[model samples]
Target: MSLTKEAIQLITDTALVATAKALDTDMPTVVIPEGAKVVNLEAYGAFRSRFRGTFSTNSLLDFGKYVTDRAVGDARGFINQDEMTCSVLFNLGTEEAPGHADDRAVLKLKATAGYQAVQAISGRAMSQKDMSDWIEDWNSTLSAVGEDNQNISLVKAIAAVRTITVKASSESDHTVSETRASRSAMDAIEATSKETLPTSLIFSVVPFEGLQLREIILRISVITSGAQPALKLRWVGEEVQREEIAQEFKSVLQDQIGDAAALSLGAFDPK
Candidate 1:
């Protein structure tokens, strides 16, 4: 999405805290300084509160960096640099009438770190289960990367983002998409749930055009279509390759984040 006039009109914010409440999601504690100066503090709730406004991806990343840098300046040494990353949630699918006389093109790009490394390890992309297994292996052993796939490293790629999912749809027939509420990702971000089940879930919204992306995504994701019930991580600036994805957008985000991570708390219902 671009930051054009129409895209600007599509901006919305519902802070993660409120987003959790509206969606009945589990909230996870996100570590941040109590009074860290933030650039977009006011706009944080635009996504869920029906207060549409447009801002670029870079702007959001900068705001996150501001907090991280401020924490360092304040001598708050409780976190790592990776914890400084930011995650943004938005939609790009639409139900434009396909009244055109001709067929149109569609592109869905997702990258899972395990898949890329597997392709590099072998000669082809692995199946979903295999990919999941690969991640499990890494999570437990942390030894999936090596001199395979021409030395393409899943560890390095995932370091940039935990998951990435890119979807473009002019039209879709799934009725669930039309009725499902947007998942309140923040609930997981702020949750301290003692229960084993999910405290929150993902939601949906009307997808519009003219949006912009500066590509600063990091850590965890949710795809709101209820039928699929999927999750994944994305690598910054990496173009997804059908044969050998560049580690850009990955699928089945369950493996990328820890149990306490936001997307993981959703209990990611598998497809």
Candidate 2:
């Protein structure tokens, strides 16, 4: 979010050139006295030099940085604004004992959600501490809901039903977690089984902390798979909850922008 001395100088030079060009076109009747070095837009260079020296000094460093960032964005392009999207990663495992790679889930803002975030961030006037606290609240308040559990922390929610137990007619119950294990377990049970097992899984999701916890129930498809067993997880009926999270996230992003709009999250490169 900072510009180097060399970059500042280059941007200043470019601005000076554009201003000189505009002045030349607008004030063609103005006369440059003979023997004056101000002929050919030299005056603009002098003015730009003095302005750059005054603003780029240590006392006005912040102002200079702001001006430079604005100029760069207007003349070139924004780093994060164009994408209009923000991505969040939810960690399902504890800090010390992290879960598998698949345990992590990513949530990204849709186009409309991103628009709301942009509006919220740009419309707010906040201080640095306020922004920090807002972010903390956003992270800590997120929780998930299940059929049996309500308002459980997102980190503790089960991403998938890792294990299930099924009983055959004459054999003891078999428990399986992986796809291969489920396939093998089903093969042995189907030989004597008359009907497929009726089972459903509960999933909890909190799109944002402090927002509503959503419940998703995915039914196991044992009859459809025949000898093989698969758990396909998908759900509906949480559109309102998702929208509420998006709105709450907008407020958080507003705090993230704080007093300086240039300091917005989109100002940085994802890389």
Candidate 3:
């Protein structure tokens, strides 16, 4: 039988009430002091211990360059120098939000040999008068220009390769730069030179406005998967960083909410 308008309204109201009751039963019950005036009961225990922060696409790239620029003793034009440009990888989805609204940007600082090269060359920018004669002599010996991208040992190993591959059923002949023996040699060189250059950089990162994480170190490691190798910078000491974030949040809360009550970092359990 078709229900009347009043009957349908009654059924809808009953369902809404039942859902509210279920939610209340499942939610944790926050105890209130006796004779306390309760206000906004739904929002009483809404304090969140963990928070998410994101950086804008351009901000991420700039931050990456800033870190490198600082590391190489603030070398002039180091960030944009053709061979020494900071390799910051990131992407903004097709649907980009205007201004700094794009939050999915995660900057990956690809630690390349050029960073070391820049460090090696930055000394040349200073005048000889600014250095002691002995220091200058030592600096001259270390002034040899380093390869922009390739490691010196790896380049030497590949240059020493003598083996060649002869294809029997190939349309065009191709020359193999590094044979298996050379690869083995390169691997040995890489094992020692993997961390020859600075692997991690200590700097500040402002993931959110007015919130700068100072002395946050990001460590990079090389990954050899396919024909081309890649570098990845991963954040370490996450617990410490999180603690700093929590403290910042706690301070802000105390400033506005007053220090009458003690604030702690934790979560609530739903019954």
Candidate 4:
């Protein structure tokens, strides 16, 4: 996060104010003759101005940013993950495709698993990349935090997700990639037949190569009655700006190329 010039000034000013308090408490009282100019609390504007100028020019930009972020983080408070409890499940599976003549298209169904573990950490240390990754799986993680209803904080929500084998029916049954999302996440997707709850606030960005992903929260409810789970494309956005994101997802899903992948999209209901 970029710190504004005003925020930097406030930081310097606050520090200067604290310094003045410490000095007044520890230093001996000074009596200056009339017209004498000794810097004191009365000259706070000047003192703060000079301090801010020096701080702004110094190469402590990183330090300044860290301090500013710390201030903001403290204001946001911390999340106690241990007191929090949640249900968890996530998985990935695939099937074969026989229609395509291309050898690379021999497989019809494919799913790649993500292996990134979720855990709460210092939000002050969170960067843009961190936000992107967290929001990508926010709903699944939230499902893990389901029904806790105890005013979940951002950092806690970010870190609350952990895959539990306790509820997964297909744990380790499908490990297409070296990395895969926790079983809890997969269970979340299957249990609700939706990517996330409607109330979930997800954050995502657009890709230059394809459609802009406006719905930070995405969904792929499946037609559960089928022998194999097929995605419900129309419900991807669940009616939020579906006109834009729905078309974009459909176009991209069609243009995508890979192994053991199915590009099936149609009207289907959950069994």
Q: Pick the candidate with the highest TM-score.
A: 3
Comparing 1 with 4 on lDDT, the higher-scoring candidate is: 4
The backbone clash count of each candidate, in order, is 49, 4, 0, 19
lDDT value, candidate 2, whole model: 0.35
- Tell me the tens digit of each residue's lDDT in model 1 across 32-110: 2233212332345434422223222323234333333333211111111122222322221123621211111111222
Query: Looking at model 2, which ten-residue stretch has the lowest summed lDDT?
Result: 50-59
Each candidate's lDDT (Cα)?
Answer: 0.27, 0.35, 0.34, 0.30
Cα error, residue 264 of model 2, in Å, equals 16
Task: Compute each candidate's TM-score over C-alphas.
Answer: 0.16, 0.26, 0.27, 0.18
- Estimate the lDDT of model 1: 0.27
Name the top lDDT candidate: 2
lDDT of 2 by residue, 1-271 (tens): 9999878877766665555433343223222323212444445453432121112211122332343343422111112323333322122234585422221111233433322332343324433234324323434332344445444342332222222234444434555776644322223443112222223334444433333455444333322233333333233334554555555655554443233333324432222
Looking at candidate 3, what is the lDDT of residue 99?
Answer: 21
**TM-score, candidate number 4:** 0.18
